[model samples]
Target: MEKITHISVELRDWIVNTMKTGASPEAIANAMIKKGFDPIFAYRTLLKLVNNTPVEVLAREQQPYIYEIPEIGQKGNIIATSDRDIKVLMRVEKPFILYLENLLSEEECDELIALSKNRLKPSRVVDTATGEIKTVPGRTSSGTYYRLSETPLVATIEKRIEELTNFPIENGEGLQVLHYKVGEEYKPHFDYYPASKINENTGGQRIATVLIYLNDVPQGGETIFPKAGVSITPKKGAAAFFHYGNSKGQVDRMSLHSSIPVLKGEKWVATKWLRQSEILERS
Candidate 1:
């Protein structure tokens, strides 16, 4: 017997269940190693299960970033930008999550909320199977999108984002303004286009998401990653950034996230999704 490297379906389910209950990846790996599995195999297996990608696909999609992000500063909290210094509040590795502070000023946040108030409409999501926008059951909110550099404020924000991520402006989508009231929520979902539903007109695959919090919710409204066992509370002028796309074009399942329901005050967010190629601004 050449040491069974294959993870059985039962074992895979157990691994996913354990992760959902808040077990760290390292702990999970240790347990599997004790059960007679290779360390490399154990690590990869956990990643594949958590990401919901096939084992073979996961192995092949372990590719490098197409563009590099500049180094984090000495304390690992400072990110150098052309005009502003973004402070990192926290970081997570498996799904590549970052909690950033002071990415926007209070004045900027208020102005954005004011600008989007009159333009808001019911939020819609892409229908994975059809590639069309539809109002789904899980998401209950309203939103609007600003064309790239549409206003002086929008342009300035976009420029700072470009400097921070090192992703080209041409590859970025419009800034989406979203509003959520008490009892509203967006269910867990991936930011990247599904492997089976890739649409060229939609600008290839979405490589990353940068979300700026416009206002703080008094009680609820947290950006949560169920599989990663992470929840980040909303704070005005703060932001969250995560990347899911790899050179092999496989999406990271650990990037699946959602907005918990607003319990007290409303929540507002401005989101920018970066794609692999240039997407012309229509409006």
Candidate 2:
């Protein structure tokens, strides 16, 4: 660990500005660590600054709502897959939303939950303007990623998702399993990378998201779309799919969503992000 006798006032100002722009407490702490500050000191410093900051100043910056919805080629109440027939219970156009039922079996859900139990770690969010992954206070859940086709079970699920979404499997990231305990939640945010943040070195903008609910929360833990004024309750074996990007390089701001705080039991979900291009080893 490195020792620092001086905590510069400039550092404080930087933290304040970053927070105002929606940087997470953990992201600030991470930036400090990269600057040679001890991890513990960086974390505590950010915590104190966050605690003292006003709510309005620390709030996430809101973007103007976008009205465009990407095309989903499949038409009908049911999305056919190689192995299962997924029923589309609901649809919303603006953000290209679909509420799917019977997307996963109880056995599959249990198996996924079991496989992820020991590997879960804190979930992270991508920096809005930097494309950097940061563990953030805004996302208060533990998660783990499973490589594509890592197991026979995962392979089957990935295949099903590919068929359901009509997306190339090669362009999709690995499966991400997330577990949110009581009181934990993910703040509202977009699935696609901001245009300002895109660069040749980075993976292309995210095209869509497939979020599967592995278990039912007896109380809260709904997936809320703030822009659309819609909330989908987490149901075991069901899933929510949404598209936020298209070929013209436009990203939908209406795709802003969050995981509502779990009020009773834990919430478990699996997420798959599809990109326009093949992302590096991981997404």
Candidate 3:
């Protein structure tokens, strides 16, 4: 008997029906082979059809990211909240980053580190395809998240950020503390996500970040913006704040940044990710 290589319409429909009736691929291939179909072709076709991978659509062309000055940019060198005073150490315009000092205090920094020291776990990223949190090689650090305003210290910091940026505290995600030992680094990446990942319930698309340095690094662990030729050193109680997204849904690709490998000492930092609107609890 001659072996069939190409699948006909009738045969394809039969195969689909057989699979839907709870037949396994191995059993289907055996049946196809008994009917004089090419063994290799039978197995391969069944496998492909079983997986049925979806095709990805091409993204439409987008306009350049429009630059919108953030509230922190308009303020004077000193930003005074009801409880604290933060100083603007430096400002970078191309990507819109602010070097802030005294966002936390010496005592606050130490306390945060101590609180998170034992609770640290390997850092993770949101899986683009599956929408799951997962660990990846690019980010090599241990970190933990604190519930929004969970502690007096956390509440104080959140209040300060709310007053400083004029964005409501409800717009911010839980505070995160990260620890990078020597040689650990977070590879360069954007903070903004693809539109599909933004969930309105957990606030909308992230618009900005307030990454506060909880402790000074003796050497490396600098926040690097490669495109802008900028490197911000980690200082105790200081921070690097960058805004990328705007109301029009435009995002600044120039806000790309990373944590360079800690060449000398351990690095500790607290991070707050801000969204476009108040975060609603998942129902």
The top-ranked prediction according to TM-score is 3
**1 or 3: which has the higher TM-score?**
3
> Candidate 2: where are CA atoms >4 Å away?
1-73, 130-132, 199-203, 280-283
Candidate 2 per-residue C-alpha lDDT over 62-162 given as tens digits, one digit per residue, 9 for 90 to 100: 33335544434365887777788889899998878999999899999999999999999888776643357777677889999998899999999989887
- Candidate-wise lDDT, in order: 0.78, 0.78, 0.82
What are the per-model numbers of colliding residue pairs?
Answer: 0, 0, 0
Q: Pick the candidate with the highest lDDT.
A: 3
Q: If ranked by TM-score, best first, what sequence of candidates would result? A: 3, 2, 1
lDDT of 3 by residue, 19-122 (tens): 54334668767767876779997888888778874222223323567888998899889999897888999999889999999999999999989889999999
Better of 1 and 2 by TM-score: 2
Question: TM-scores for all candidates?
Answer: 0.74, 0.76, 0.78
Ten contiguous residues minimizing lDDT sum, candidate 2? 54-63
Q: How far out, in Å, is residue 248 in model 1?
A: 1.9
RMSD of each: 10.0, 7.8, 11.9
**Count of backbone collisions in candidate 2:** 0
Regions of model 3 farther than 4 Å from truth: 1-60
When 2 and 3 are scored with lDDT, the better candidate is 3
1-283 per-residue lDDT for model 1 (tens digits): 3444776433454355445433466776776676677878888877877788775433433444353232322336788777778899998876887889999999999999999999999998765433446676678899999888899999999998888887788889999999999999987776776554555665788878999999989999999999899999999999999887776665667777889999998999999998877775343
Colliding pairs, model 3? none
